[model samples]
Target chain A: MSNINFKNIKDRQFDAIVIGSGASGGWAAKEFAEKGLKTLVLERGRNVEHVKDYPTTNMYPYEFDHRLETTYTDKQINPIANSCYAYKEDSQHFFVKDHEHPYIQEKEFDWIRGYQVGGKSLLWARQTQRWSEYDFQGPERDGFAVDWPIRYDDIAPWYSYVERFVGISGNRDGLDTLPDGEFLPAFPLNPVEDHFRKSIQTKFKNRYIISARCAHLSKPEPIHIEQGRVQCQNRTLCQRGCPFGGYFSSNASTIPWALKTGNLTLRPHSVVHSIIYDDKAGKAIGVKVIDTESLEELDFFANVIFVNAATLNTNLILLNSKSNRFPNGLGNDNDLLGKYVAFHNYTARITAEYDGLLDYRTDGRNPAGGGYIPNFRNVRKQETDFLRGWAAGFGANRGNVQDRSGVGAELKTSLLDNSKWGNWNVHSHMMAETIPKEGNTVWLDAQKTDKWGVPLLHISIDYASDDWARRDDYYEQMTAMYEAAGFTNIKTSNDPRRPGNDIHEMGGVRMGHDVKTSLLNRWNQLHQCQNVYVTDGACMTSTGTQNPTLTYMALTARAVDHAVKSLKTGTI
Target chain B: MNGNRINRRAALRTMLYIAAGTMVLPACFRESGSKTIGLVNMTINEEQELLLAEVVETLIPSSQTPGAKELLLHLFVLKMVDDCHSPEDQRNFTEGLEGFAAMEDPATGTKFINLSPADRLRFLKQIGDQDNDKITMFYSMTKRRCIQGYMNSKNVMTDLKKYELIPGRYIADFKIG
Candidate 1:
């Protein structure tokens, strides 16, 4: 703390400067501010106040110009961002236009991002699950990529630490692969879903399906309640942002806490382009930033720098930051800064219709009503084909009467009349794990630059043969189980979907033991630069088949602790 | 006077005359064009709007609670179709209005409006159940559009059912069926 004397630059500099205010940046800011460090957090987009800024949260679909769907113009302007169903009129403002920051694709790659204060944390599907030993030790077991510097045991306490604060909602299923966390009560499954769960359990001895572990405050704990958060309203308009602070987001939780500390300084509309690496000092003294609104460049100095600008964006910044000592980029000694990119293989799910459940109806309309089956395939025993395993998230609900359609006077009359009948439907989605391939990477495109005059990322990637094989196996197994449960009109589909459709972008500047192979060390501290630490999805050694936000938060919290300790010990 | 001043004076006179003429136009024209119905805003004129509201109210009348009109279902449907529906669908909707006018009540040998409530319901049911593609498509379209309008209304979401802004605790054992 003495080494970082703000008195010397109280009129100019901060003790720490955190880049990107998404999941990781939010945590870093909160931790640094709480620890009494004068921290400055930079966000590329407009400041979004939790409830007030969520203009569409309380708005009904009928009120929207596109009725919760994307317009033709929106699709045309943002081909990649508009691919996801969530990227619609209701929440499109949260995302950046692809054309605005055009990235060349050597192969097709989807880089879905939200460049706001809360970042993608505002729009993330809050299915928070702990990565087991399998995820941490996958590289070691399969000898695919380098092994993870940290293991599940090392991060277990931090996971608990994050869950306790964020208020995760789940059941205490004592599974090894998908470990349970400090959870609020789990949401109930529909009657049909319960039947399917029981039947699947009986048919498959080792496999299990439990309720989805989400980050919604199902029940406000003492900490959550103290933070002035509320319960879930069951109005599944989460992407639009919850006005009640019912879900976990940087806007709803961390940023507000940091602001309350008064030690935090948040500069919105300021996009950090690169870290100013002082070659003589052998440290990152400050960061170079561009104001998205003003189109003006500025440099801010700080002792410690935390790059939480998501996965790809952080890599882009690091790669763009060129110095005399490190010509390739800062911490690019091995030239592995933006290589071995991995994203979840989403195309793995089986859908089926049930006849008897037509009469059964649930009163409350829950937008997020479903259960998840953890990865139980490759944990205790190994699969002959695939090394890693995947998990399934299934949801069941009664179809609305609005599902019916007609034309002319009859159509008009039927719509006006509410006494209509409809059938119930069940849907499911699977998040499959893909092995890290060195060929898949993100590099800088010299031709393209964003509105802020930063170099655009060139993503070159695709699903490997092993990923396709695993997806095939996933479809076959899921179909067999659904058929066994007596579900009729069963249709199974794999994610013929593109790379970024799942919205879980990982890898690129991954953590590893060997400096020659990876960018960051075990503590998420860059090998070449001691002062700079990246704790976003970029720090992930493996892309496990779970929502990665929770893990990112845990890592960010752990890294902040390490950074603070390192500062005290004169390591930086 | 200058050419621009002469032109401006002529334009102003023409605008005043048109505005005065529109004041005497048929109430339907004035009402239909004026109304702007949607989630955030509700702007509808008098006369037939009340009738439309009444028609929807009768279909889902108040029992223990307020009915469709109170829920602003008609307004919501109108706004959604006007704003949200695809331009092609909007064009189809205009053409479909002709099909609606062609509908006759057998009892009265007149349009649907001339019939009693019971007869109206009977006439609608018969046409609604028809297997013809055109008729079925019309029925399906109207049904879907109306449901979209009604269900998404704030009145329906908040007034009728239990609207939990946030159900803090998720009880897995709760009865979902």
Candidate 2:
């Protein structure tokens, strides 16, 4: 308490401290600041202000030095990061380079990362699907992972709350497996896609397809106008960072909203060392940080602290935080800090040509991707050998094929011709779910440390038997569906990309009912230390068959509300 | 505007042959100032650059509208190949360029640079049909870059294609007859 007398100590103290400035951390910042608490968000990377920081947002194809192509050197250097579909010349700056922060891969793992104020939120594909009761009860019903502490009913209102603010555009898809949320209008499916939907509905049993719900301002409400954003312009260049604030990002939405409250202090270039636990206080008091430029260590104190440093990083931070009472890690009682890590499987893809939709072609672009075939297998009962089911992204479009043959004036004429549209092509990629196991783990390396003296992470996660069986099932089912749709030349391929490339890695410090298996409780508060909350992907008990950002935002909002209430009642 | 179109490079090329040093080296032609500007990484000189420009001009010559050369696609090719291409592709291109002019026409027995326009076109078409290793690499790289540059240039995008920066709507069933 003697440090409280120092003038600088007051500047360093806050009502709440959030570890990261990513999707979940941004929500924590906004919610805490809006609730009249002085919030401090610590980001480990450079600050990226909203529209003004998007360097390549408005650039054309020709404006880029190589016509927006990923150069050979770029691919050679960043073999893993450049393998991502979004890692082009325009959006490459947002993605972290390969060797920028090295990690030990016991197995082949491509840890795709973005380190900045917005984090991966700026470069997200923006598919925001609400998890249903099926997802909440999966682990319990199937007897695989630990049961989720909170059910869909407990977090349904939070989903609606986050959806309204985040401006999720989706249809009220009436299904028990994939529940609907508060949404704006959905981006329409092309003719061929709609044809396939009709085909599957008439023929198959439970194959429900709808437009993938996405985080975009389709029709800006008064709240969105207040946030200073407009309707999405269908640019589909979202990885470059939307200049119009058409998409939701930490830089575009939550951070600015938190700053507008005048109670938020965003501290970039603060690499968090660990949570500082006080043995006498019997809880976490503050966080230790290493300045990115200087090697100096500093500490920031707060009454309540939120650890939302993505998923693997949140586990790393907690696993590194050591105290006299708990030397293993903060809130780690039963050695469950960095176990049961899982990621979504995005290996399989099926492409086919639909020649019937010759007269119909697509105009402009779809930022919401296309149609989403929600999890159909093992919804009501476990029909397959796998524990969980998989969702798929389906879209149909024609290419702007040119007859660029011959040399001289003939080539010139063909190159200028934009009227030649090729046959309509359809494609679908699986979002398979992998059951988390003890073998799939991430921990701090014994010897190697980063320049900041933090132990480098060593990841050892691989696909299980269920993952392989699901890939084969996806291939068999998709090929049959394509044949039924009267499509020809159906080609199915499973790209041999390793795990961690999906950017949906989750469940290390997971939330559950029992303290023996989980680190966080129902309210996302640490079991032993109630003041420290982890509401990011780290808090997920099980990975649902959907893009996990929407669930993360909902969980974060719910946890903040619980924290604020607990703070008032002196329970935290 | 017409009189001022010629830059200092053109003026220098037309007027002077400098005695830069008393001890001149054998490769003093590099100081002749005919080399194109602003390209980095790739090792290129004057004659090879002119040969690339002529190849681009031959690929998409001028007619009613601006051609590949008029749109400065040769500069784009050099820039892209220099910065964007692989080291192996760059090496192949450089090696292929050394033997480009010496490719004697089978019918006329004349060098490629000395042949008539029709004969030059036929020679390139014949060379393209054959799977000549280095020459094929050079041709493919040049053609791909030239077409990309020409199709995406401001003139083509604005006047010909009408690429909307913000297309506002996605028509699911747009008709094309």
Shift of residue A221 alpha carbon in model 2, Å: 0.7
Docking class of 2: medium
Question: Per-residue alpha-carbon lDDT of model 2 for B68-117, expressed as tens digits?
Answer: 76566776787788778878888888777776766777898897777776
Tens digits of lDDT, candidate 1, A1-572? 21333235453488899998987899999999999998999998889988889988876554564457665455667889988767888898898788876788887777788978899888988889999987888888888878999899999999999999999988898988789899898877777788788998898977887888888877788899777788877777789998878888999999999989988988888888889999889999999988776677778898899999988888899999989988888899898878888888897777778765554566544434687888766776676577787788887665445423332334434434444435446667778888878888888877778767788888888888887777777777888888887877878766567887787778889898978888899999999898999999888778988889999999999999999999889898
lDDT of 2: 0.86
Interface RMSD of each candidate, angstroms, one decimal: 6.2, 1.4
In terms of docking quality, model 1 is incorrect
Give per-residue CA lDDT, model 1, range B1-177, as digits (tens).
358555744564454346334232222324366443222222334543554454455455544444565455555455455555555554554345445445665567776556665665565556655444454444445455555655555545565433454444334333323
RMSD of each: 8.3, 4.5
lDDT tens digits, residue span A446-495, model 2: 78899899999999999888898999999999999999999999999987
- Which runs in model 1 stand beyond 4 Å of their true positions? A1-10, A60-62, A355-368, A399-424, A494-496, B1-143, B153-177
What TM-score, computed on C-alpha atoms, does each candidate reach? 0.82, 0.94
TM-score of predicted model 1? 0.82
